[model samples]
Every structure is written in structure tokens, then in C-alpha cells.
Target: MTKILIIGATGMTGKSLVAEALSNGFSVVANGRNKEKLNALKSEFSGIEVFNKDAFDLVKTDFEGIDVIIDAFATSPDQAYLQIDLAAHLIALLRNTTIRIGFILGAGSLYTDESKTQLTNDLIASDESTKPWRATPENQVYELEFLRHVKNVNWFGVSPGSNYIPGKKADNILVGNDVLLVNEQNVSVTTADTMAFKVIEEIKNNNHNQTRFTVANG
Candidate 1:
């Protein structure tokens, strides 16, 4: 079995990924910074290991026997740059190794059209309500750009649709590369369950290595 460790496992996306991985019979470890939340997870989840620690403080020794590490860490909008910093830190740690790193990136990094322009530009231009929270998406774009230049670490990233909600999986899934994904109705939304399914499915398939992809409801 592949030994997997999930950072930021207390969040909606990370928790869903942990549950999906366990349901599929993988050896899973969930790491977080909150002890109370970790204990809550232990009672709800029957067979997964939990670790309480900050993601930035994790060392190579912590990942010694792990086959894959999922970087699901999140931060406040003002401190979104930590997302890119954490990506670089993990990339530096896993260089030249077979251990794969999977990142959950924002859809703002996905292209909005064939011109290859990032969706983040449109987001910044169009929405005033998102202005306060745009830093997170902007930093996520930087994270993907940084990952694209890395050649030594086995890495891949996934972007959720425009509106990523916390909910059950949809009946259908639509996946794509780089570009924003939309369903038949032209709506771009993905649930936590669908995102987790796609993530664990990618971990199992091992395709899209060193690249990023997007997913949506379709």
C-alpha cells in the first residue's frame, strides 16, 4: 500500500481527501496544527493516523517512509504568500526523490481562454467582492508557476472549478488541463467530494506528473 500523508487535513478539502483515501484502503496520515480538530477527526475516523504540527515545521524525517505527500495547507488572504513559500520548501526537501507531491491549487491559475492568459487576471478585473480575498488566488498562481519550473521533484497539482463548495460529490465529473472547466450548463462549480475523488484517483493513476489540471461538475 502507498503510505500517504496529508497536510492541512482539518479543512474541508483535506478531510474529504483523507476519508476517500481511507475508504480505498491506503495507509494515511493526517497532519494539522490544531489538537482539538485532530482529536475530533480521530473519533470520527477509525483507521488513520493524526499528527498535530504546523506544516512549515515538518522536516524530511517526518516524511521518511511516506510515499506521497499532499500539500493542502491554507492561510489567510493577507498571508497567502505562505502557500508559495510552503510549495518551494517542500519542493526543496523532496528534490531528486521518487516521493511525489500533490498540490491542491486554486482555479484562478487556470486559463480562461485559448490565449493562455490566467483566470486570475479576469477575477481581479471583474469582481469587487473578491478583491479582499484575491491574494490567496494570486499566490496560488505563483505556486503553480514555481512548480512548473521545478524539474527534480515528482509533482502534480489540481485546480478546482470557479466555485468550490463544501458538499457531496456530484453524479458526474469534468476534468481538463490548465483551462477552466465548465459543465454542460456552462456553470463552473465543484464539490469537496468530487475534488477528493479526482485527487485520490490521480494519486492512484500517477498520470499528469509534473503538471496541473482542473476539474468541475459535468
Candidate 2:
């Protein structure tokens, strides 16, 4: 079995990744900064190893036996740029080795159309109702851009659609490259369950090396 480590394993999407990867019989480790939540996950799920350490503090030894890493780490809007910082940090750690890296990318980076641009600019310009959370998507876009130039590490960035609801799997999942995917009702959404399944598939397949992909529910 492939030994995998998940960063931000206490978040909603991270929890789903743990559950789905366990169900698929992968050797999984949960990494997070919150011991309480990590303890709760341990109590709720069997066979999951937990590591309570800050992302910035992780050293190469921590990844000694890990085959793949899922970067599901999240931060507050005020500190959203940490997303890029963590990506850089992890990239630096895994620079020449074969250990693959995966990311739960932000939806704001998805292409709004064939114009070859993304929605982060418009989202940043939205009204004050979304005032407190704009920096997150802004920083996520920066993270993806930085990862695009990395040549040594095996990386994949999976971006969820417009409405990313962190819950059960949808009946069907739609996959796309760079573009915003829409269902028949023209709504763009991706559930945490579906995202987990797709990510684990990518981890196993190694089909999307150093590329960014998007997912939605149809």
C-alpha cells in the first residue's frame, strides 16, 4: 500500500480525504496543528495515524516513509498567503525525491471562460459581504502560479468548482482541466467526497503530473 500523509487533516476536506483513502486501503497519516481535532479523528476512525505538527515546522525526516502528500492545509483569510508559503516550503523539502504532492486548490483559480484567465480578480472585486474571505482565494491563485514553475517535484493541483460544499459525495463527479465545470443545471459545485475520490485516484495513477485540474458535480 502507498503510505500517504495529509496536511491539514483536521479540515472538512482533509477529513473526507482520510475516510476515502482509508476505505481504499491506503496507509494514511493525518497531519494537523490541532491535537484536539486530531484526537477526535483518531477516536472516530481506526487505522489512521495522526501527527500534530505545524506545517512550517515539518522536516524531511517526517516524510521518510511517506510515498505521497496531500496538501489540504488551510488558513484564515488574514493569513491566506500562508497557502503559497506552505507550498513553497513543501516543494523545497521534496525537491529531488520521487514522493508526489497533491493539493486541494481554490476554485477562484478556475478559468471562467476560454479567455485563458481566472475568476480570482472578479471575486476580489465583489462586495463587502464577502469582505473577510477574499484573501484566501487570492492567495490560492498565487500558490498555484508558484507551483507551475516547480520542475523537480511531482505535483498535482485539484481545484474544486464554484460551490465547494464539504459533505457527502455527489452521485456523479465531472472532471476538467483549467476550466470551470458546470452541471446540467449550470451550477458549479463539488462535494468533499467526490474530491477525495478523484484525488486518491490521481495519487494512485500518477496521470496528472505537475498539472492543475478541476472537478464539479453533475
Candidate 3:
């Protein structure tokens, strides 16, 4: 069984990844800083081993015996820069190693049109209703920028659609390389479970190496 470690396992995406990995018979090592949430996760999935440590403090030794590490780390909009910092830290730690690193990024990094206009620009120009959370997506865009330069470690990035919500798996999914994905109804959304399933499939298949991809409900 491939030993997989998920950072931020207590978050919404992280929890789904944990469940998906376990259901597929992978050995899961869940990492989170909150002891209470970690306990809750352990209760929900009895078989998973837990790692209680801040992502910034994690050293290479902590990843021993792990084949893949999924960085699902998340933070509030005001502190969104931590996203890039964490990605850099992980890439530095795993440089030149065979361990595959997967980053859960936002769709802000995606191109919005054929001209390659990034979605982050439009997001920054959006209305006041989205004022507080804009930084989160902006920082996620920066995170992807950082990863694109990394050439040593095995890395792949997964970006959810415009509307990423908590829900069960979708009946159909559409994958894309860079531009934001939308369905015939002109809806751009992805359920947490659907994203988790696709990500796990990529990990198992080892395709899309050293690149990023986006997904949406079809």
C-alpha cells in the first residue's frame, strides 16, 4: 500500500482526501495542527495515523516511508500569503526526492480566455461583496507561480472551479489544462468529493506530473 500523508487533514478538502485515500486502500497519515479535530478525524477513520504538527514546522524526517504528500493547507484571506510560503517550504524540503507533492490550489491561477488573461485579475476587480476573500485567491495564484518554477521534486497542482463547495460527488466531471472550466449550463463548480476522487486517481496513475490541471462538474 502506498503510504500517503495529507497536510491540513482537518480542513474540508483534507478530510475528503483522507476518506478517499482510505476507501481506495491506501495507507493514510493525516496531518493537522488542531488536536481536537485530529481526534475527530481519527474517530471518523479508525485506520488513519495522525500527525499533529504545524505544516511550517514539518521536517523531512516526518515524511519517512511516505510516497506522496498532499498539501491541502488553508488559511483566512488576511493571512493568505501563507499559501505561497507553505508551498515554497514543501518544495524546498522535497527537492530532488522521489516523493510526489500535490498542491490543492484555487482557480484564480487559471486563464480566463484565449488571450491568457488570468482569473486573478477579474477576481481583484469584482464587487464589494467579495472584498474580504479576494486575497485568498490572489495568494493561491502566487502559489501556483512559485510551483511552476520548481523542477526537482515531483509536483502536481489541482485547481477547483469558480464555485468550490461541500457536496457529494458529481455524476460527471470535466478536466482541463489551464483555462477555467465550465459546463454547458455555463456553470463553473466542483464538489469536494469529485475533486478528491480525481486527485486520488491522478496520484494512483502518476499522470499530469509536474503540471497543474483544473476540474469542474460537467
Candidate 4:
């Protein structure tokens, strides 16, 4: 079985991904800053390993024998630069390591068209509406740059659908390169479950290496 490490495993999407990984028979090492929540998850999923640590502090020692690392942490939007710095730090630590890295990116940075940039704010108005997600900084751009400069590491940034929320898996997902993929109705969304499913699919297939891709339900 492949051993995988998940950063920010207590978050909304992260929690779902952890459950999915366990269900798919992957040995999972899940991380979170909150000990209580992390412990709760551990209790909920008796088979999975759990760690409480900050993202910037993660080391190969914490991931010994791990085959892959998934980053699901989100920095505060007011400190967007922190996300970039964290990516750089993570790349530095994983530079010579054998573990592959996968980032759970925010939809804010996805472009709706080749010439037009359609960020997350474009879809949702008012900070009150996007309060929860908007508080988290997005680094789709910097994450890609880090991958380009970092050698000996295979990395991928997976952006959720434009309107990600908790729901049943639609299984109607569209996958694409740098450009954001949306449905014919010009709206896109994916359930936390489907996003987890897609991530595992990419990990298993080793697809979209050193690149970023957007996913959405069709």
C-alpha cells in the first residue's frame, strides 16, 4: 500500500480527503494544527495515523517512508505572501526527498478564459459571502513557480471547482491544464468527496506533473 501524508487534514476538504484515502486502502498520515480536531479524526478513522504540526515545520522525519505529500493548508488572505513563503519552505525541505507533493489550491487563482482572469472573487461577491474561504490565502501562481524551480520533486497543484461545497459526488468532473474548466452553464462546482476522488486518481495515475489543473462537476 502507498503511504501518503496530508497537511491540514482537519480542514473541510482535508477531512474528506483523509476519509477517501482510507476508504481507497491507502495508508494515510494526516496532519493538523488543532490537536483536538486531529485526535477526533484519528478516533473516527482508527486505521489512519494523525499528527499535529504546523505546515512550515514539516520535515522528512515526520514523513519517513511516505510516498506522497498532499498540502491542504490555507493561509489567511490578508497574509497571502505567507502561502508563497510556505511553498518555498516546503520545496526546500522536500528538495532531495523521494516523496511527491500535491497541493490543494484555492479556486481564487483560476482563470476562466485564456485571455480573461476569473478569480474566486468573480464568482462570489461580498466578503460576508466568501468569509470562510476568502480568509484563506491562495497561491496557485507561486505554487507553480516553486514546482518549476524545484528539482528532484514531482509536484501538482489541484484547484477545486469554482464553487466547492459539501455535497454528494457528482462524478461529472472536467479536468484541464492551466486554464479553468467550467460547465456549459458557465458555472462550476465540485463536492468535497469528488475533489478527494480526483486527487487520488491523479496520484495513482501520476498525471499533470509539475503543473496546475482545475476540476469541476459538469
Candidate 5:
């Protein structure tokens, strides 16, 4: 069985990924900063091993037997740069190794139209209400740019659609590369379980290795 390690396993996306991974019969190692949440996850999923520590504190030894590490790390808009920092840190740690790392990114990094206009640029031109969380997509774009230049590590990235809500899996899924995805109703949203399902499917197939892709509910 592949031993998958999930960083930030207590968050919405991370927790859903954990449940999906276990449901697929893979051994899971969950890492998170909150002790209480880690205990709760461990209790909820008796098959998982919990690592209670900051993601930055994780060392190579901790991943000795892990097959893949999925980075679902998230932070406040004010400190969104940590997303890039953490991606760099993980890339540096896994350089020249066989371990594959996956990242959950924002759709802002994706292009939205025929002119190839980035969603981040569109967000920047939107109303002031988006200002509070604008830094997140901006930094996530930076994170993907940084990952694109990395040649040694095995990395993959997945971006959710405009509305990333917390919920169970959707009945259908749409996958895209670079361009934003929308369903028949012209809705661009992805539930936590749908994202998790795509992620685990990617891990099993390795179809998007060394690249990034986007997903949406269909």
C-alpha cells in the first residue's frame, strides 16, 4: 500500500483528502499543527497516523517511508506568502528523490479567456470586497510559477474553481488545464470531496506529473 502523507490535514480540503485516501485503501499519515484536531481526526479515522507539528518542522526522516506528500497548506490572506515559502521548503526537501508532492492551489492562477487573461488579474479589477482575500490567489500564482521552474522534484498542482465550497462530492467533475472550468449551468464551483476525489485519482494515475491542472463541479 502507498503510504501517503498529508500536510495541513485538519483543514477543509486536507480533511476531505484524508477521508478520500483512506476510502481508497491507502495508508495515510496526517500532519497538522492543532493537537486537538489531530486527535479528533485520529479518533475519527483509526487507520491514520497523526503527526502533530508545524509543516516547516517536518524533516526528511519523517517522510522516510512515505510515497507521496500532498500539500494542502492554507493560511490567512495577510500571510499568504507562506504558501510559496512552504512549497519551496518542500521542494528543497524532496529534491532528486522519488517522493512525489502535490499542491492544492487557487483558480486565480488559471487563465479565464481566449486572450489568456489570468483570473488573478480579473480579481484585481473586481470590487473592493475581494481585496481582503486577494493576496491568497496572488501568492498561489507565485507558488505555481515557482514550481514550474523546479526541475528536480516531482510535483503536481490542482486548482479549484472560483467558488471552493465545503461539501461532499458532486455527481460529475470537469477537468481542465490552465483555462477555468465551468459546468452546464455556467457555475464554476468545486466541493471539498470532488477536489479530494480528483486529487486521489491523480495520485493513482500520475497523469499530471510535473504540471498543474484545474477542476470544477459539473
Candidate 6:
């Protein structure tokens, strides 16, 4: 059985990922800052191991034997710097591990065209309206750069649709490479369940290695 560690397991997307991992028979180590929520999840899932610790406290030994690390943690809009700091710390902590790291990232970084500059400008502008969303691609770019230079650890980052939330599963998710994928309606969206499925699917397939991409329903 593959062992997986999930950071930010109390959030909506994180919760769905946990459920999907459990259903797939993977051993999960769920981490969250909230003690109550972590305890509740522990009580609810028979095989889940819960950790109520801050990101800074994570250690290499904590992730020993883990096959993958799913990073779903985020900071508030005003706390962008904090998000970068946390990501740096996480990268440093896992530097020695041979495990793969799968980051649950925001969609703001995806490109709609061939020119990389255009997509970057658009993503930065959209960040204003998407303030409530945490860890925009602007911040993740640096995280990705750090991860790329690291040795031994394989890293993959996935960005969900523009409006991802708790919704009915459509079972129709579109996958793209370094581009913003949208539906026929021109509005990209994904449910938590679909996003979770993608995460598990990547784990099983080992696709999109050392890169980031976006997902939506089309």
C-alpha cells in the first residue's frame, strides 16, 4: 500500500482528497492546524493518522516511508509572504526525503496563449478579484522553482478550475498541460470530488512529473 501525507486536510479540497485516498486503500497521514477537526477526522476514519501541527514543525522523520506529500495548505490574501515562507520551510524540511511531492495549487498561473508573459500578467491582475483564494500562482512560482532545483524528490503541482468548491460531481474533468482549460461555456470550474480524483489519479499514474497544470470540466 502506498503511504501518503496530506497537508491542510481540514479544508474542503483536502477533505475530499482524504476521502478519495481512503477509498483507494492508501494509508493516509492527515495534517491540519485545527485540533478539533483533526480529532474528528481521526474518529471518523478508522485507518487515518492525524497530525495537529504547524507547517514549520514538520520534520523529515515525520514523512519517513511516505510515498507522496500532498500540499494543500494556504494563507490569506494579505498573508502572501507567509505562504512563501511556509512553502520554503516545507521544501527545506523535505529536502532529504526521496518521496514525491504533489502540490495542490491555484489556477491563476495557467497560460491561455503561447506567450508566457501574457499569462503571467493576466494571473497577477486576476489575483485582485480572487483575493479570497489563497496561495496564488505568483507565490507558487517561487515554490516551484525551489522544488525544481531540489535533488532526489519528484514534484508535481496541480491547479484546479477558476471556481472550485463543494458541488455535485460531474465526472467530466478536462486535463491540460501548462494552459488554462475551460468548458464550452467559457467558465472553468471543478468540484472538490473531481479534484480529489485527479490527485489520486496522478499518484497512480505518475503523470505530469516536475510540472504544473490546470484542470476543469468541459
Candidate 1 per-residue C-alpha lDDT over 33-93 given as tens digits, one digit per residue, 9 for 90 to 100: 9999988997889688998989888888889889999998988999999999999889988
Q: Pick the candidate with the highest lDDT.
A: 5
Of candidates 5 and 4, the better by lDDT: 5
Clashes of each: 0, 0, 0, 0, 0, 0
Residue-level lDDT of model 6, residues 134-187, one tens digit each, is 445567656666656766557788877767788655667898876777888988
Tens-digit per-residue lDDT, 1-218, candidate 4: 99988888988778888988888899999888889999999998899898888888877677778998898776566776767777787778887667788888767667657776665545543456665555453445555566667667778888876678887667577887656677888877877887888898888998787877778888
- With a 3 Å backbone cut-off (N, CA, C), the pairs that clash in candidate 3 are none
Computed on alpha carbons, the lDDT of every model, listed in order, comes to 0.90, 0.90, 0.91, 0.77, 0.92, 0.78
Error of 1 at 34 (Å): 0.2
Runs of candidate 6 with Cα error greater than 4 angstroms are 114-117, 120-137
lDDT tens per residue, model 3, 1-218: 99999999999999999999999999999999999999999999999999999999999999899999999999998999999999999999999999999999998888886578657437564767778788888888889889999999899999999899988888899999889888899888998898999999999998898999988889
Q: Give the TM-score of candidate 1.
A: 0.96
| Poorly placed runs, candidate 4 (over 4 Å) | 115-138
Model 3 error, position 218 (Å): 1.3
Give the RMSD in angstroms, all C-alphas superposed, for model 6.
2.5
Clashing pairs in 6: none
Q: Residue 162 lDDT in model 2? A: 78
Q: Comparing candidate 3 with candidate 4, which one achieves the higher lDDT?
A: 3
Off by over 4 Å in 5: none
- Residue 40 shift from truth in candidate 2, angstroms: 0.7
Pairs of residues clashing in candidate 4? none
